[model samples]
Target: VFFHNALPFVGFGFLDNAIMIAAGTQIELSIGVVLGISTMAAAALGNLVSDLAGLGLAGYVEALASRLGLSIPDLTPKQADMWQTRLSAHLGKAIGVTIGCILGMFPLLFFGDEEEKLEEKN
Candidate 1:
């Protein structure tokens, strides 16, 4: 149950991982720390940041697209690198945490108990 509660945090980090992977970060799940409590923490943090930043990122990109009359998905190599660096620099931990949470969540969901526990009623 203790570990079971931690799944969402792990799931929260997927966006961060995607951004980092685009930015060329090396992910080593084979390492010890990658799956430790740190990973869980990272995932929660990522979720936190993504929840907040995702909104802004979406709006910001939309605004940029409107202002520049450019396609958001068509970022140049330098633009991609710059954005990746910026996002990573500010949101690295959160991103890593998000990634960890996403990957971490699967096991919990698949293996978690389907039965519900009822509390005592007076």
Candidate 2:
């Protein structure tokens, strides 16, 4: 679960770093907005994929354990529900980051002084 939760953060950090190096001070506000939106979308989609894969793997592991006659602890219904929720949230974050990074790379439109102003307002 720890690893699962950490995946999106790691992915987003990488995306952010890539964007910063690619754009730097040359980025504009419009480009930043576009990048932010795109990265978010992509991160969300990617997170969903990751969540599904993790769930699938967990299911497989449980099944294998059962087949091997090993005693596996059953997850509480609430725990399962919470896990799903967290997975969805992580996925959404990942999509956001992916979209943001891609759009952020546009120097003329995204990484501008106006963006800093907007950010300050937030």
Compare the candidates by lDDT and give the number of the best one.
2
User: What would the per-residue lDDT of candidate 2 be over residues 1-122, giving only the tens digit for each residue?
Assistant: 43333334444544454445433332333443557555455445445554555555545544543565544335576875796766765675576556645653554454466557767976
Provide the lowest-lDDT 10-residue window in model 1: 113-122
Off by over 4 Å in 1: 1-36, 70-122
- Quality of model 1 by C-alpha lDDT: 0.41
Q: How close is candidate 1 to the true structure, as a TM-score?
A: 0.27
**Candidate 1 lDDT, 52-117, residue by residue in tens:** 655555555435435654332444678757866556444644554556646644433432232121
> Candidate 2's C-alpha lDDT?
0.50
Model 2 quality (TM-score):
0.28
lDDT of each: 0.41, 0.50
TM-score of each: 0.27, 0.28
